[model samples]
Target chain A: MSPKDLEDRLVLAIKRAETQLPDDVVSALEKAHEIEEGSAKVQIEAILLNIKVSRETGAPMCQDTGIQTFFIEAGADFPYLGKLENIITDAVKRASSEVPLRPNTVNPFTGKNPGNNVGRYVPYITWDIVKGEECTIHLMPKGGGSENMCALNMMSPGRGIKGLKRIVVDHIVSCEGKPCPPTVVGVGVGGGADLSLKLGKRSLLRDVGIRHPEPHIAELEEELLELINESGVGPMGVGGKTTALDVHIEYAHRHPASFPIGIAVQCWADRRATVKITKDGRVEVI
Target chain B: MATVKLNTPFDKKDIQNLKVGDTVYITGKMFTARDECHLKMLELHKEGKDIPFKPGDMALFHCGPVVQKKDGEWRIVSAGPTTSIRMEIFEDEFLKTFETRMIIGKGGMADRTLAALEEVGAVYVHYTGGAGALAAKAIKKVTDVYWLDELGVPEAAWILDVEEFGPLTVTMDAHGNSLYVDLRKEIEKNLEKIHAKIENS
Candidate 1:
C-alpha cells in the first residue's frame, strides 16, 4: 500500500476515535444510567446527549482532544516497516488540522504550542512486533482530566496483593471527581515504574466489560470494580452508586525486591478506535 | 434539586439563593480562561492595566477550547470545561480581584475555592466532563478573543455569547456548602471498608 493510503486510513481512525464513543463504552454507560437516580442520572443523561451530539455533528467529544497516542502491533515481515514512524507522524499532523483536533502538544519549558498536535516525542506511538503479515493500529485519545489522575507506586514485595488493592482503592478514592468518574480504572502491576504505567494505560484499550484471560486477574478486576463503585463517586463525582464503569488490570513479572503499581484512569468518554492493514494492502478501520 | 436559569452580570441575590446541587443554565456573556489565562489576567491586574473584557460581569469558564477561524470569524468546535481544580490556586484571588460571579468547569474545586465562593457571593458549577459538542451547541457566537497570539488559542480568553448554556450543577455555593467536600468524606468512609475487605480476603 502507498504511504498516503495508510496515512488517510490513520486520519479516518483518528476521526472515528474522536467523534464516536465505542459501543462497549456506550453500552456500559447506558447500564450505569439505568441504575442511577437523581443528580447521578442527570449527569449520565447529559453524557449520553453529548455522545449523540458529537456523533451527529462529527465534532470531537471533548475539548481537550488530548495527546494523540497510537499503539501499533506490527508484523516483523510487513512491508514499509522503516517508514511507519514518519507516515504516522505526517498523519497526525494532517489529522490535527483536518479533524481540527485541539493543539494539545506544548513545549514544557517554553510553553510554546506547535498549533498542531505534533511535537517532540508526541503523537506518542508504542510498537509491538509479532510474527504476522498484517499490522493493526489503535488510537486512544486520552483526555487531560483523567490523565492527570495517573499514579505510580513502588511498594515492598512483602506487602503482597492486599497492599496492591489498598493502594489502588486509596488512589481512586482520593482522586474522586478529578479523574471524571465514572472512570475506567486501569491497574498495571509488577513492572518497573514506566513499564507499569505503560501497561496500565495499555489495559485501558480493552473493551469495557471484557475480563482478563487469567481467572485470578479477572477476579481482581471484578473486586476492584465493586470496591471503586462502593466509593459512591458517581458520574462526575457527585456521589452515587457507580464510581467506575469498570476496572482493568494488566500485570507483568516483578523483581523480588519491588512491586510497582501504576494506575491509569480514563474518563467516561473512553474514546478509541482501530485500523487494521493486511500485507495484501487491504485496509479496514473499526 | 431545582433548576435555575441565570443571565450574566448575575445579581448577588441570585447567586446566594443557589444551593449546592441546584442545576444552572447560564445565558448572556462568559469568558473562557484556563491556567495561562488566569496567570495572565492576574499579571494584567498587577500591572494596573484593564483586561479587554469586564470579568466582573461575566461567568468565568475553566476551558481550553478547540476553535476554528473561517471567513474572518471565530467558531467554537468543542468548548467543554477543563478540570477546575487546576485553577484552584488562582480562583480565590481571581474572584476577589475580579468579583466574577460564577464559575463553570468540570471536576469540583477545593477548599480555597469553596470558601471564596461563599465570601464573594459566587458559585462553582460543573458541566459534564468531556461533553464538548453539547457545550458548543449552547455557544451562540464568539464575541471576542484575548491573547490569542500571546497565550495561543487554547489558553486564550474566548469571550463568548451563549444561551441557556448548561446543565451546570452548582457543586460549591455561596452558602458555605460544597458537594465535593461531602463526596470526599463519603469516599473516605468507603475506602476504609474496602481496605478492610481487601485485607480479609
Candidate 2:
C-alpha cells in the first residue's frame, strides 16, 4: 500500500517479465516445434535457441523490445489505487532505462522523441477494475515488426467463413517478411472495435497449442491456420509452409450489423509475463 | 578465412569471388546509420551535398542504436540490426549513388533492389538481428560522429573502427541468388502438401 511496496512490486514485475517467458507461450512454441515441417523447422529451432540466448545474456528477446503494454486487472479494495498510476509510469521509465529496452516508443507526429519512456500514449496501460482484493498484471513487449501486420474489419455475417479466411490470409501474405514469421496469429471476433482489438491481443496470451473452448471457433482456428500456411509465407517470410505457429481466436457479442474481427500477429519471440499480488501482500509470478 | 579488410569500390572480380554463406570481416572506415539517417542521406544526395563516405564497398548497418554519454562523449548502449524492409523505398537509389559493394542488414529485398545490386556489383549480407550486444562488441572504436549536434546520439552517424565485424551471410549475392526468397518458396511447397494431408485427414 505504501510507495516503497509499490515500487518493489513494480521492480519485481519488470524483472520477472524480463527473465521468464510465459509457460503457455513456451508450451505452444514446443508444440509448434513438434509438429513443424519443412525449412520452417529450422526457424523454429533457431527461435527456441534465441530464447535461450536472450535469457542467458539478459538481453531482450528481440532487438525490437517492443512497446510496453500492460493489461492490469485490479481489485476495488486494492490498497495502492491512488498512487499506482504514477508508480507504473515511473516504473516504466526506470525499466526502459534499466532494462534498457530498445527505445521503441516514438512521437507519431514529430517522428522524433527522447528515445525513452516519455511519449504520448507510451507505456500504453489498459486497466480493468474488479471486485477482488488483489491485482493481476500482464505485460507483453510488442515489437514493431509484428505490430505492422495487425489488421481489422467489420465483416458481413453473410460473408461467413470464406470471407473471414480471405481477409486474414491476404493481410498476412501481403505482410510477408515484415512481421518476422513464423508468427502466432491472434484473431478476435464479435466484439466492437476496441473490444475486438483487445480480444485479438488477449488471444495471444493463450498458450500456443490450446484451442478455443468452443469447438467451432477452434475449428476455425485450425482452418485459418491451414489457409495461412498454404499461402507459403514461411519462416521470416522466406516463403515456407509454416506461415503461422498457431492461430488463437476469442470472441464477444457484437452489433447486429457488425462482425468485427481483429488480427494481431505476434512474432516468434512473443515475449509476455504475468504477476499476481494478493491482499496479504504476497506476490506470485505466473 | 579468419579476417580480411577492404575499402569501397570493389570490382567485378571481387564480387564474383564472394559467395553466399561466406563470413566477411570488414575494416577501413565504416559508418553507423539506420532508417532516419538513410532518409536524410538520400535527401542530401538529391540536394548535391558532400556525401558522408563514398557509398561503395562500405557496410551501412540497418540499426537505430541506444546510446549514452560519459565524460562528454557519446557511447553505444545497444546497437543491433533492424529489419531492412522498412528501408525498401530508399535502397535502390541509395545503392546507385554510393558505390557500396557490401550491404549488411537482415532480410533480403525484392526484384528491383536485387537488380540494382547485381548491376552495381553489390552483395547483400544478412546479419543476425537482435544480436545488438554481440554486434556492439565488434565496434572496436568510435572515430567521429556527424550530425551529432542536430540528430542526437542514436540517430547520428557514428564513424566506427570495426574488426572481425561480421558473421554475415550473402542472403542476396551479386550473382542474383537470394537465400531468403529461395527458402520461402521451398517452405511454401512443403506447406501446401501438409495442408492437403490435413484436409484429407
Candidate 3:
C-alpha cells in the first residue's frame, strides 16, 4: 500500500484507540459496579456513561489522549521494513490533528509543545521483528493519571518475592484513589530499570482477567488484584471494595545479584487498538 | 452525604458547610491552572506583579484540556482532571495567596494541602479521573484564556463557564476532615493482616 494509505489507517487506529474503551475493560468495570456502593458506585456509573458517550459521539475517552505508544511486530521480510517508522510518524501527525489528539508532549526543560504531537521521539514506538510476511501494530492512548502511579524499585535478591510484594503493594496503597482505582496493574519483575518499566507497560496491553501462562506468575497477579482491591481505595479512591480490577505480570531472566521490579497501570478506560497490514497492502483493524 | 450546587466566588461559610464525601456541582465563574500556572502565579506574586484574575473565593481546576481552533475560535475536545499531588508543594501557598474556595481535581491531595484547605476555608473536590467527555458536556464555553504563548495550551489558565459541573466529592473539606488522610491510616492499620497473608505466598 501507499504511504498515505498506511498513514490514514494508522489515523483511524489512533482515533479508535482514543475513543473506544475495550470490551473486556468495560465488562470488568460493570462487575465492579455491581459489587460497589456509595461514591464508588457513583464513580463507576460516571465511567460507564462516559464510555458510552465517547463511543457514540466519537470524542476522546480522556482529555489526556496521552503519549501515543506503539508496539509493532513486523515480519523480517515485510516490504515497508525501513519505511514503517516514517509511516507511523505520518499517521501520528494526521491523528494528532484529525483525531484532534491532545498534544501532551512538551519539552521537559523548555516546556514547549510542538503542538503536532510529534516531538523528538514523541509517539514512541517499540519494535519486535519476527518471521512472518505481515505486520501487526498496537496502539495504546495512555492517560496520565494511572501513568503517574508507575514506580520502580531495585531490591536485594534476599528480599525474594515477599519483598517484591511489599514494594508493589506499598506503591499502590499510596496511590489510593489517585491512580483511578479499579485500575489494571502491570508488574514487571527481573529486568533492569528501563526494560522492567517497558515490560510493565507492554504487559498492560493484555486483556483484562487474562493471566500469564506460567502458574506462579498468574497466581501472583491474582493475589495482587485481590489485595489491591482489599485496600478500600474503591472507585476514584473515595472508598469501596475494589481498588483494582486486575493485575498483569511480565518477567525476564535477571542477574543473580540484580532484581529490579517495575509497576505500571491503566485506568478503567484502558484504551488500546490493533491493526494488521497485509503484504498486498490491505490495512485491516483487528 | 448531601448534594450542593455552588456558584463560584463562594465565601468561607459556603465552603465550611461542606463535609468530606458530600457531592458538589459548581456553576458560574471558574479558572483553570495546573503545574506551570501555579508556579508562575506564585512567582508573579513574589515579584509584586498582579495575577490575571481574582482568585479570592474562586474555583480552580487541575486540568489541561484538549482544545482546537476553528473559525479562529478555541474549542474544547477533551478536558479532564489531572493528578493533584504534583501540585501539593505549591498548593498551600496558592490557597493562601489566591484565597481559593474550591479545588476540583482527580487524586486526593496530601496533609499540607488538607491543612491549607482548612485555613483558607476551602475544599478539595474529587471528580472521576479521565471522564473528559462528561466534563466537557458541562463546560458551555471558554470565556477567556491567559498565558497561552508562555505556558502553552495545556498549561495555560483557561477561564471557563461551567454549569452544574459536577458530582464532585469533597475528599478534603474546610472542616478539617479529609477522606484521603483518614482512609490511608485505616488501611495502614489493616496492612499487618495483608502482610501476613501475602508473605512469601
C-alpha TM-score for every candidate: 0.97, 0.84, 0.94
Candidate 2 runs further than 4 Å off: A15-20, A23-49, B1-14, B18-30, B43-57, B69-77, B128-144, B160-169, B178-201
For residues B1-201, what per-residue lDDT tens digits would candidate 2 score against the true structure? Answer: 222345444565776567655556666556766777887888898898987666554577777666656688756545656788767787878788776677777666777778788887887776654545556556667767878767765567777767766556566878887776676666556545654654454
Query: In model 1, where do residues sit more than 4 Å from their true spots?
Result: none
Q: Per-residue lDDT tens digits of candidate 2, residues A33-136?
A: 78666334545555666566556656555656677788889999888766667777777777777776656667778877666665777778788999978988
How does chain B score by TM in each prediction? Answer: 0.97, 0.87, 0.95
lDDT of each: 0.90, 0.71, 0.86
True contacts kept of each: 0.83, 0.18, 0.75
Candidate 1 lDDT at A219 equals 93
Least accurate stretch of 10 residues (summed lDDT) in model 3 chain A? A224-233
Q: Judge candidate 3 at residue A83 and give its lDDT.
A: 95
Worst 10-residue lDDT window, candidate 3 chain B? B191-200
Between candidates 1 and 3, the one scoring higher on lDDT is 1
Per-residue lDDT over A1-286 for candidate 3, one digit per residue giving the tens place of the 0 to 100 score: 7777888888999999888888999999999999998778889988988888788878897898888889999999988889989988888888889988887778999867777788888689999999978999999877777888899988898989888888888788788777777788888998788888899999999999999999989998888888777777788888888888888999998889989898997887788999898878789975
DockQ of each: 0.81, 0.28, 0.68
Best by TM-score: 1
Candidate 1, B1-201: lDDT as tens digits: 899999989999999999888889999999999999999999999999999899999999998889988899999999888888889898999999999999999888888988888889999998988889999999999999999889888789999999999999988899889898787787778777887899898
lDDT of 1 by residue, A209-241 (tens): 999999999999999898888878888888898
